[model samples]
Target: MPDKKLQLDIRIIKFQDLIGRKPDKPFGYYGLGVQYMLSGKPNMADKLFTQALNIKPGYMPAILGKLEVLLAEKKLVSAARLYQKNRDLFSGKKIYKTRVQRITGSLYSGKFFYYYLKSIRSVFVFNETIGALQRMFNADRGNPVVNLLLAMFFLKEHKENERAFILYNLCVNMEGVPDKLRWDLVKVLAKDNPDILIDEKTAALFTTIPEGAVGEPYANFILKQFILLKDTDKINQAFAEFQKNHSFPDPKTMWQYIEFCRENDIWDSTVFACCQKLIDYGWIDRTIAETIVGLKNRKIIEYTRGMDKILSLYGYI
Candidate 1:
């Protein structure tokens, strides 16, 4: 199979071909624009979204996509203007209106105010950003977007990982929590010191992460936690779930899995098969390959590795 980057490139080309044949279809343009955005071609994405808007004015998805590109590029003025121009679409929603207002007011010269606030938070305005976010939180405690914003501030600005983790948990439990927020929560936790996150509550949080929200690298972190606790059942369960979703692991995660097997003395056929798969993918380290060879030489290992067997074990087949 082709690597992920190559597969994504092929998919993008297919989307572009479809868009070429259906020039008038807003959805086609919007879909291609999304692909471009994900592929880190924001300029192309912006133009495609613009094309989508030209074909179908007030296309909400395309409008949002364009706004995302603008925000990502730090074109705060353009983003604010775009939001203002589309006020009619968002006027009925209080949260959307508030966000628009925030964006409009946050623009200073050409940059977003958060950039400046982040710069001065530690020196001149120690508590200004946090204080403002706290007020917003007090006003709407259940708003996941507000909670996530506040959690990020605490995590990045104040280095309060515990506080951020708590807020993230709360957001995850709330209704209408975005998938991005769930993924970001895992990322923030993973970036923190592992020693600080080894407690039962944190482990529970990792285990209970919403399905489809735990990215592969994040799943590796959860696996490491299970390994640290020597919870073989949870480790196996997490690995099963991880494999169900992700077929090709990155080199770092592949190495980490090998390390986990080594530490736990798990010389099963499945472990050896996974090591061999990594070797095939050119992701296995030398030591891991040597260990797998030693395991294979010690005894006749059964060939029990396949997606069907995994799915059957998890009652998915």
Candidate 2:
């Protein structure tokens, strides 16, 4: 494989060639500008971005790119003026408006905070931003957008789980919160407090997870929670429900289910049927199938002998 620097150089050459051939194409200029920006040549990026805007005035992406360059250079006044000139493009977007408002407000109120917030996306120095957000939280604790942003910042950057959990809870409780955000909050909460997955308030959120890529995490979490609780009835019900929807369990969930069955001494048709499904789907190899057979027949020593291999296959070890 090509190294990272070589990959970047290849992209730069490709974008340069495309722009050379299509000098009038605004998107070509914009694309090359992005490549320049990624290569740490913001001055070159600024020139190409300006050329794009000159060709097609008010192009949103190019405008945003130029603004990014200005912000990166700490040219706050220019960035603010550019935003004001194109504020209509950001209309009807709550998040963008909130961010712009915060930056501008900080500019007038405190230059230190203004510069800190302005450089956040580039530098990611969270201490000043967190302090500013804390003051905002104190003033308007019910702001869902503020709560969500601060919660994510804490959860991802600071590893402040309790603080993040509190903010997530507050954000989800507010009216008009999106279902996707609510589901995300529930997932975070479920990781720390699995009991909440079975709560009445979160029942609707669990059902919002559709089948396929987006649903995998929720399904895995729900199945793992039932396994941890040793709630065979719930597991069976969930399995049946998922089957009805033609949604098969992921490999991780299957592993947890098999382990739960062994631990709970559930050597019935349910265990056999799930084992058959796992084998059929190629989720478990022949060795695990043999171990399952041993467990089914109550051959404790035989099953114990292969326990390490089984756990390793499932990534437990």
Best by lDDT: 2
Instruction: Give the range of the ten consecutive residues with the poorest summed lDDT in model 1.
Output: 101-110
Residue 40 in candidate 1, Cα distance off native in Å = 2.0
Model 2, 1-317: lDDT tens per residue?
Answer: 99877888898888888888988889888888888888889999999999999999977778778876875565544564576567677454655544543332222222444555555675444565566566666766654334655664544454535666778667544333444445556667767787766664454333234233234556666666667677667687777767767766776677677777766766655565566566566576554565465654674333333544655676544
**TM-score per candidate:** 0.41, 0.40
lDDT of 2: 0.62
For residues 67-168, could you state the per-residue lDDT of candidate 1 as single tens digits?
Answer: 778756755335645655676775556666444333322232233346755556375354654565566567655443345456644544545456566775
How good is model 2 by TM-score? 0.40
The Cα error of candidate 2 at residue 11, in Å, is 2.4
Task: Tell me the spans in candidate 1 whose CA falls farther than 4 Å from its real position.
Answer: 1-9, 53-71, 74-139, 158-169, 172-317
Give RMSD to native, each candidate. Answer: 12.9, 13.2
The residue ranges of model 2 lying beyond 4 angstroms of the native Cα positions read: 67-252, 255-317
Q: What is the C-alpha lDDT of each candidate?
A: 0.60, 0.62
